[model samples]
Target: MSQTVSDFIVQRLHQWGVRHIFGYPGDGINGVFGAMNRAQGKEGEIGFVQARHEEMAAFMASAYAKFSGQLGVCIATSGPGASHLITGLYDALLDHQPVLAIVGQQARNALGGHYQQEIDLLSMFKDVAGAYVMQASSPAQVRHLIDRAVRIALARRAPTVIILPNDLQEEPYESPPRAHGTLHSGIGYSAPSIMPREADLDRAAEVLNAGKKVAMLVGAGALGATDEVIAVADRLSAGCAKALLGKAALPDDLPWVTGSIGLLGTEPSYNMMMECDTLLMVGSAFPYAEFLPKEGAARGVQIDIDAGMMSIRFPMEVGLVGDAAETLRALLPRLKPKSDGAWRQSIEADVATWWKTLDGRAHQPAAPVNPQLVAWELSPRLPDRAIITSDSGSCANWFARDLKMRRGMTASLSGGLASMGAAVPYALAAKYAHPDRPVIALVGDGAMQMNNMAELITAAKYWRSWRDPRFVVCVFNNEDLNQVTWEQRIINGDPKFEASQRIPDVSYSRFAELIGLRGIFVDTPQLLGSAWEQALASEMPVVLEVKTDPEVPPLPPHITLQQAKNFSLALLKGDPNESGMIKGAARQVLETILPGKQ
Candidate 1:
């Protein structure tokens, strides 16, 4: 029997260093699976992971790329199977991660004839991968298409697609594959550092030197330049405020480091931005322009590798288009150290007071578990090298504010898209990338039920393959969309409609057990520690379902008068859920306005 096109595709993937393929079996892609079976026992052969759905497969693939810094690959059959991969593919594209998706099409002759399970997969994926979507029209084009898709995804940090027709996949290959140079194994397709122009560097320094008070806003792009960023901040004697995505960039223990700077932010960060006369933004294109300094209130100097993102959020006085570390290094030599440390000292003092205040709130005793306390108790218990993922909702707020990310720990969230149901996939991918380390996911009941609960079975299926069985999923059973409900009350001046915002009761821990995994449930604060210990000690995947108080609102660092007015209107609307709203407001207002805590 002669080799088929599917065989060549698998060979090309092996040469490019793919170790895992996340997908589900289907008739449209039966030929590809046949080739996979034939290549068993070969060196560098890929392992197949069976997912409950194609969307979960795509999410896992994207997260694999994020944690491992490798080209993540996903496979799906034609028609609806391929359509299900769109949302997760967008997740990768929005986060700027590299992912390659291979979807099966109908037989070559039935492509446009509306045959069974037939659809134009190319046109469907055009929006996501307009530049990189290709079809293997002939057997000779199989190898080249695979190579091009992988290279484009790696170099550009974007998603690429390859459509394989069912008929062509089983055809005999007539020509030899073109020989291409081996890919570099070190950093996998990273470009050289881009240095900024001397003139732009000088102008940035001039703006900083002219100001009496300065502040630096850091983002994820500055992760590699942590040391350089600290050096520049120390030289300028500037306070550092981190964007939510940059939460783990620097240690929170740093005296001058103010925490996150948006809705899920701290008072110190908000105050630092309000007082600074000059802002130095490094590798951060943080949205929410209202949180930033108003026009003419502060002079701005921005640094980013993508020139297109320059001045997109706030107007910059000097935009230095270059790599973060290199630009900071160039600007350091021409800058002068601030003669006064008073500004930085004051900011540090405020940050210390905020921590004490947060601790007091997190430890408050209540009927049900307080969400903030969950983060507080779990933070000290995690291993130094643990990987954590958070779902978007009120749970994310607690994780952002109360959780402490040390120097060695890594955490991820959907910062740009703010999507729910990513925690399950994120944790699975992290465990696959570093099987020896612990992986945890902090999710809400509302988010857990939203297309991610089924993923628990997927985790159970792959449990035996992991070297370390320290995977934990902490479920916050709040029974409501607490984040958006609070937003409706505070932003829209609308009362919470119980029917619409409430989530039906479901025991997530029981669901875990039914899927053949360890499960623990806690309804009170006293059992929080014991539940976590049990999870860590179990030599298998565990889900800890903690019944949390939905009444405790995740308040922002600062609130305007208009927001207060909206809450008052909700109270006057005579809704039955007004007491929780009133209590949350009182707690936040009293703590912020009263001076005794300081």
Candidate 2:
């Protein structure tokens, strides 16, 4: 073939530094796959990762962008394959990860007749595509559409979609200025440094400085700006609380920093939100308005790159529209250090006490295993550069609270979408992005069996690609949808329904072995460390299955009377896991009500 549209697409992707494309091959996308095969040389090589499912491909792509800070790319065929990508695409879109999705459509001639594998991809992708959603009508539109899609994804930091009809993929570029000019080179762009106006910064600083007790909420938009955020926090004497997505933005070891906010929150964060006189929201649009101070309870200064996100979460006295780091830098100079350290010290004391309480809870022995202790063991053992991904469930609660993130370590989950089955793909993408760094996936048993457990094979297939393979899958084999079970008992006021939340017991370690990867099974607390060591030593992907107690509830830092009432009802209804629920309630009461006395 003499330089088809498919060839140009691959070539442009290479130029833009997209080293990998995650997707499954299908008949509708055969033309693109064929062109991908023909591309050669160092720059021409865009690794096409063959995921078992299109959903997994989309997740891998989303995580690739998240970990590497690059534009992640995924492709799929028309109809079902394309539809399968929606959830993952939504995950990326809602979480604000830069992703480019290319979906194959039926040939132009058969598009409207509802041919086999035919779907109007543009219509299907409209909602999740963020802004750039277009079809490559002809070969001439291919390069332009691809360029715009990439630009939109990068500049907007959201997903963009390009629908390629099967016939369009094979069409030759005939209307370009020149063949080589059309398939351009040296295409690069830089994000403009966004800083708030001087007056806005001064006003924000004034509002921040005026308050006696300040609390700052940070998010992923403040990534790599840890110093600026901390500087502002220090200047304002603010207790900082990270939104779940910004869990790794600040080291958990920081005395002034509270790990996370909302339901999966720390006592310090909860108390700080309730007590703050001023709130400075740095790049976080944390959706839980209920977790924030009541309107007019605190004066707020909100800073965000997107003007739309500022002041949306909380009532703002000063809304600074700019980049988080830049705005913070400007505000820091204008802010005066607080005279009273008592407010900061009080929050610090609460944080210290909370940790001690958590340590007591995590280490306490259980029948199968203590889930919190498992996370604690893994946290200290993780390499400084380890990239951790957790499935959304009770596993997230453990990982969020117990997993102590350091300066270099990074962790993420489906924060915005709160979806499961993403941990495996996220880990794979992190490994693909930085093969030298250790990548670990913390998944609950419920999430492990969801749809794409087959993607573990993808990790096995690509094991040798890494020079030092240190990918480990830590499965919390509690044999139930523990998070949802807890939710059912506490939120919905129902006894544990075995059929809905209970999971069939699976030997995840054996499954790993069967898939041609190393497996480490841990049923006892004592074996956890050894299993982790063995996993780290293995030069291939290792799945460490930790059989934990399904009964041990993943309790929140603060418990409400409503939650307690629901649990009591469940216990009265002869809930099989009654002991755990009772114990969880007792612990919450002891921790919250009897803090220092306990």
Candidate 3:
């Protein structure tokens, strides 16, 4: 008996434990899709999601991969469809995620006489993959290339590309079976670094013996090390605060976990990151150079697995290259918990004052509706089990700063590259990953519309979706790339604010309705309760679109002289029109953070 290459690929993917494939069918790829259709949903596994764009398919699959801790799969025809996968693949690479991209070729016979949709995939993807292999040129090549590609993807925990030809789609293929191979799971952690072990604990102990005004800037790597992180903070009589991504690694309500850092970071974190005399970096490599206090402003120690990252962003007196959990555990027992809590009251008072000031600045009184106000109101209302995701913009800063976290919650985002289109697909994948937990996306108007919201179809089509109908999207529809516009004002020195910054005024409610998802569009807070309540009730996907004042300028996370001037200029841009008002409000918000006052 024999089967086509397409059939063999699907069968092997199944054996590889891939239960879903995200992609759009194309000319040369029809055979592959048909083959997958034949083998799907059997033995409690394997299915497909037909995405509107190859890009979205890749995104959704990438999210699924990240959430499940398994390799994600995507299929595309050669040329343009294959090209569409680059962005998502790049995202996976940055996150160190695993993905297998299987592309359909023109056919074995059509080897580059400029055949339609032809691509030198080897050349095109060499930079992006751990491995790239085209259709088995020879019979002996198939087993090796396929096995090698799968191995590389798992080993590198990045992308592996396998290009199959149309003619080989069903080439009579047979090979003797080998022993069941090890999966190579490829997931491993480096041992905790322990150098000057006695002194490191002694140094931390010295700070604890001396005072209580110590704090931590915990990062993503701090996850699962919660007990040790908290205990170390306790030993030093220091409290803990997290980076935006570090939100999940620790609980939000804990007295020590003070929230994120830098601009759009929580007021408590801002006050503490600056106020603490000794700062400890637990598993995070925070990159915002401007946000850190002057060198030696606060004596610091950083712990990380990658030696290079020990103190790359900011200098540290003691750098430990190791796992956060192991390092923290070893440092304990030897370190003493302080008897009298020095500086805790002072730090607490300052933290309280900082949050009080931010409270007024974060929310507003007047109308046309502020985007900040919308995000502020919604963040509190979300469920305890929410897996929140955000798009980069003014809203991202707001979400990172204000969104409350519970132990059950998880948040994901595209770091610094700040891509706009990932919100919805991430939400879908979070739903797939957690299923029972609520998944919400807090997106700006420009970001929410990315990928054209077609992921709603994928959401609706899933046979078993996340419960609580909690995979809802609350979009801050301000209708402009406000961050870019803000940059134009602060750095570019543009004068009068312009309405042209608003690219489009698409009716989001209408679009959500078109997709059969519940759509709630609002202009007033009076409608928020019902809109929110009903949206949460939806059995399928829900889109709560709130029209916001486009001119609402986001406030800085914390303030400095340079920030004061930039915000002042942004205020200067505000005219009587919408953009002006936003600038004005932004400037007003900055005024509250005037130095010495905080």
Candidate 4:
């Protein structure tokens, strides 16, 4: 059978389980877009999404990957369109996401000449992709390259680029596929191996028997194995806390869950993990070596499915390469309870005390509204199975601390390398993939502006399709880098820094109304409840724009004491010439933290 270069690329994507592709049509890639359209109509496994910009297309693809645990696919034309995609691709790379980016190139014969939009794409994207490729002049190499690209993307957890020359896209090809990859259920996040060697279980049991004060620190890897993890924690009578990703694994409201660890991680979580005599690391390989306590004789039992990662980031005394849940289960039976265990109660009390202080840390009557109130307010309206998407920045850590995710409700993110404009598209994918479930987006004004706000239209389309409309997009209108500004006050001596000074005003409410979505704008915390009430009850996609102070403190990932001091200095040295912003911040913070005094 004869197939065009475009058809070959589209077909290969189907073979690799990619469904939705985001792209903008350009002259350089007209051939590929046509092929994509034909495949969508006939084959129908993959679908096309027209994007306003190249960056949005890549952002959508990256978010889709995290949501589905599959490689996300995006397309763009060569030259400017291709060039515009670099930022989004960088986002995908830094965040460790799997994405396949198809870009157009000048015709094969016109490569070296000064073509209108010629760029050294392969060389430019060398650092950005997990793998890179140029279109083959012949049909045979195209097939091989496509296979290699997908493998590299999935294996390395980064984006891959395939720049197609205009002529190659027009060429004809035919063949049966050479090979397909098989799944090894024992590895990766979804199908965690439950069976561990008896020796490992025995070792864990011995550790529990010897340790008087043990703490179990679970990470995202521990998800799906929550029950198993808890069972092990119970067996050891160990105090339990989580890494940020682990937030989805266990119920945050659970009395047994101590708190989350690391930067922006709760104080209760930090103290317990730091003070424990023996720490059991599960599912998560937290890269911050300094966040963990230095063990003398106290040891760590690290368990993960990825064998290579057992001690890749943190030193461990006993490295168990298997599923966290499975290893815990096997180990639980072999271990006897330790005598004179003081860690669990003491840690639990400390954690509870920290929770009490969180009221002071996050909540207070503020005129512009506290960011924490956004999540705390949004949670009650969402159904138990809602899917929440978070952007990086103050919103990311704020939502993490504020949102209470039940097991079925997923909180998807780009982890340590937080990307700002990913939430809207990610939420769109979740709504598309799980039509029955509700999806909410917690975004910052700065973040939402970057996504072009066209996502509202998509949400409206989704809402009309389902008899029950259950999507909400909430934008916290804090027109600054509130997180960074908090540090500026302490370190730079400038209490207020307008990090978002260049951003234009966003009348998100009016924009949502223009796009057929329900728009509810609130400037105060009190108004949030009513806005949320109406938003939750709306028959279509709803948008809640909350006017928040642009000077909130950051929800940091764990920072060193020295780093804290440096941040304080940044606040002290903050440009005093920007005193208006400083006063604005101090007022906002005072309003939220201390009322009636001023």
How do all models score by TM-score?
Answer: 0.94, 0.96, 0.86, 0.86
**What is residue 175's positional error in candidate 4, in angstroms?**
2.7
Candidate 4 lDDT, tens digit per residue, 1-598?
Answer: 4679788788777877777788788988998887876776576457777666788778778777766778888889989999888777887776567888989888888989998899988887888873565555566667767877787788767799888888878888644344564211111223334466777767766776777778788876777688898787877878877776677778766665776666657766766666777878887866766567774636778888767677765567777877676677777778776566566777667756655545554565454687777877776666778788877767876776666667677777656556667778777767656667777888888777767487666565546666457778888887665555555554444445444343676889889999777788888677777788888777788888988865555544344576556545655665543444445445434543464344
Q: What global local distance difference test value does model 2 have?
A: 0.85
Q: Which stretches of candidate 1 lie over 4 Å from their true place?
A: 174-190, 594-598
Task: Give lDDT: candidate 2, residue 364.
Answer: 65
CA lDDT of each prediction against the hidden true structure: 0.84, 0.85, 0.69, 0.72
Please write out the lDDT profile of model 3 over residues 105-212, one tens digit for every residue: 777777868988888877777777745545556433455566667666765567878877767766766553444642222223332344446667667556545544
lDDT for position 505 in model 4: 68
* TM-score of candidate 1 versus the correct structure, residues matched by position: 0.94
Q: Which has the greatest lDDT? A: 2
Best by TM-score: 2
Best-to-worst ranking by lDDT: 2, 1, 4, 3
Model 4 vs. true fold: TM:
0.86
Model 1 local distance difference test score: 0.84
Over 1-598, each residue of candidate 2 has an lDDT whose tens digit, in order, gives 5888888888888888888999988888878898889885545988889898999999999999989999999999988999999999999998888899988889998878969987778888999995899987777767678778898899998999988888888888554556564654236668899888888888887888799999989998888789998888888888999988888889988888877888887778989999999998887868999789989899998888888887788879888888888788777789998999999999899889878777777766576798887888887788888899999988888887878889988888887898899999998899888888989999998888985368899998998988669889989998889888989888877889988988899898999999999889989899888888889778888999999987777776667899889877777788877777676556545655564453
Question: Any runs in candidate 4 off by more than 4 Å, and if so which?
Answer: 131-134, 176-205, 295-298, 326-330, 339-341, 360-362, 452-454, 457-468, 491-495, 498-504, 555-598
